[model samples]
Target: MDAVNLEEQAARQQLFTTLYQKVFPAVAKYVSKCGGSFDEAKDVFQDALISYYEKSHTADVTINSSEGAYIYGTARYLWIKRYKQGSQTKQLDDSSAYSIIAETEAAPSEDKLLHFLETAGKRCMELLRSFYYDNLPMTRVAQLFGFSGVRSATVQKYKCIEKVRDTVKQKALTYEDFLE
Candidate 1:
């Protein structure tokens, strides 16, 4: 079984290497002409390759007839599907757009709330982290936090949530407050 798995992995690696060599330049050219960066082109090409491979494995995909064209078209379609979805027609080449995103994410109001949570609500935050962030089961959380059982842990979890909810309501957090 291990040998068979190794052989399959080798075949897949070879296929990927061959496809990237044979088809990537054209995909990169198309992406660049479309004003996308080299990294974005690589991402699109890799995703298209994986999609093509998966489709070929599952069905009678006739990608051999025009491998280059098929790969390029798939990559372009994926890029458009990913980046141009909804009514958003944002340009990928614009650095300013990304910087604006970074700025908004760094909003001062949310930071203040988070900092307050860190200080004032540290124990609740720790419990939430153990259960939710660390993905510990209620049983394990109860064990770690010295609760009697899962039910006790779960009740405490809800209590923490209600406390945070009340705090948020009391402070009247808004979208702008959440944003940087």
Candidate 2:
């Protein structure tokens, strides 16, 4: 079951990667013309791809535009939608809106990934919790993890971080929170 899930993830990644390579240059150029950031371009692209996939799955649907055009058009529409939403944001303070947007963007993926690792990656959870939550020093963590020294323990810790961070990043792009 887990292996099946992993394969699904791999295939999805390949599809998205191929689509990105094929479609991104045009989308990126168009988005920049409309004053969008790189991250905004990415968000628009993902939403466009999901929209395309959903549309394709419906019976008897016909797209007048080519796939790349559909994606670009959808992304342009999403960018406009995002701009409208941004304009309506209440002026609490300059920084407040940014903080709120940042939280809205980050919290779901970070929380869910942490929750997942807490279950599936016991060693990772333990190491992260000890280092971060428990405020354990590097030397102590090395002793606890039996890494012989701080340098070795630090290296292992960073490797664990990279693995979890990569998972979090990729899962974030899937709009996993949108499903819930």
Displacement of the residue 63 alpha carbon in candidate 1, Å: 4.3
lDDT of 1 by residue, 1-180 (tens): 699999999999998899999999988988888778899999999999988888778766556656667778899998778667633765566797788888767766756666646643777888988987799999999998899999999998898888877777788876567654
Error of 1 at 72 (Å): 1.3
Which whole-number lDDT from 0 to 100 does residue 88 have in model 1?
76
> Candidate 2, residues 1-180: lDDT per residue as tens digits?
699999988987887788889998888888899888888888889999999878976888988888888898898888898889998975788799788887676545565656756643788789988998899999999999999899998988888788766775777755546233
Looking at candidate 2, the ten consecutive residues that score lowest on lDDT are 171-180
| Cα RMSD for candidates in order | 15.0, 17.8
lDDT of each: 0.82, 0.82
For candidate 1, report its TM-score: 0.45
Error of 2 at 56 (Å): 0.8
